[model samples]
Target: MKSRKGVRAAVTLAAAALGALAFDGTASAAPLPPGGGSWDHVWKGSSGDFTIYVKEYGDVVSICDTKADGKTPTVWVGPGNGHTTQYWFTAPGGKGACNTKSSSDGAKYRLKRGQKYTVTGCAWGCNTWDFRDRH
Candidate 1:
């Protein structure tokens, strides 16, 4: 049987050790899986037409565009992940317009490390009237 004094001493040492290792405290949004397998693959469109693969918390690994008419837009301009891209598009009924180009596509594009990429544009501006899938 261990004495009470011995148990108290052991717990005090453990607390000191834990305090040393927990400095500069930071937390994660999701628990990392075993062997570092906490990859998050989310489909974040309203219609579920695109897939964004994020690994290691916020690293975007790959983006898969499933829709035939859907164009995978890049956050950067000038010869991006696709051949066709628009700087900005007007909303339906031409009420508002947003400009995203940097004077003929020379803007520096850098992905943020701990932030989410959001493409805010007119939701109904790029809709096609007729979409026929032949698969």
Candidate 2:
């Protein structure tokens, strides 16, 4: 009986250690930006193809496409309040050139401060990230 109890405790400790390691790895995989009062940029893709870049500042987001590649860079923004409405943005310009869209250039959507939103970028494929408007 004593040996059985010892084995059980060792197994539990090992499982707990493994669980902690997994959680730590997952947390480190996607790190959030610092909250409020600053701008943050998030992007996806590589130099071999095209890159989709997003500049988020306060309630505004700007998207840029780095290559032509026949793939259009797009951004999807949705407010995190259980709302189904999502706004989108696309880079504007000719192919094989850098195209950008922001409030200063043309039509753009505005995010609400203090609201959390999911931003997804797509050029070759789609990648999603979360952003909170704290400013």
Candidate 3:
């Protein structure tokens, strides 16, 4: 029932809309990163007076002590998978402290991924301090 010009105009408009999409900046989904991104399991454990956790992301390692049930947690990180370098952080300003780490200058201790480490200096979450599992 519509005029041929109207039909032709409608078709032209649709084609133009599709053409605009073809030139859009977006393309196919991004490709995966090299090495396909490797990740190791995090380790966490708690003693009679505390709880601790250790995790590794890429080249970075994080240790946390979530003072739970009035217990201080001990966290640990081990140089595994040929990974010898990592970092550290203390939680809640200071409830659990890292007693052992890579060197004598830092809170020191050894902990493997999926394993838990005991904490000292910051125990029982008494002072609301969380120690960075330095090792």
Q: Which candidate should be chosen as best, given lDDT against the real structure?
A: 2
Best by TM-score: 2
Per-residue C-alpha lDDT of model 1 across residues 1-135, encoded as one tens digit per residue: 112211101000000000001111233122111232333322223443332223322222223333334344222111222233323322111111111222223323223333223222112122111111111
lDDT (Cα, 0-100) at 20 in candidate 1: 9
TM-score of each: 0.27, 0.51, 0.24
Q: Arrange candidates by TM-score, highest first: which order?
A: 2, 1, 3
- Which candidate, 2 or 3, would have the higher lDDT against the true structure? 2
Model 2 scores a C-alpha lDDT of 0.42
lDDT of 3 at 69: 48
- The list of candidate 1 runs beyond 4 A from truth reads 1-38, 75-135
- Per-residue lDDT of candidate 2, residues 45-128 (tens digit): 433233333444324454545444666667666766324445675654523333334434433455555667665566665555
Predictions in order: lDDT: 0.23, 0.42, 0.26
Per-prediction backbone clash count: 0, 0, 22
| Displacement of the residue 118 alpha carbon in candidate 3, Å | 14
Q: Rank the candidates by lDDT, best first.
A: 2, 3, 1
Tens digits of lDDT, candidate 3, 66-113: 333444333323233213323333433232322222332343323333
Give lDDT: candidate 2, residue 48.
Answer: 27
RMSD of each: 24.1, 17.0, 25.7
Residue 44 displacement in candidate 3 (angstroms): 1.1
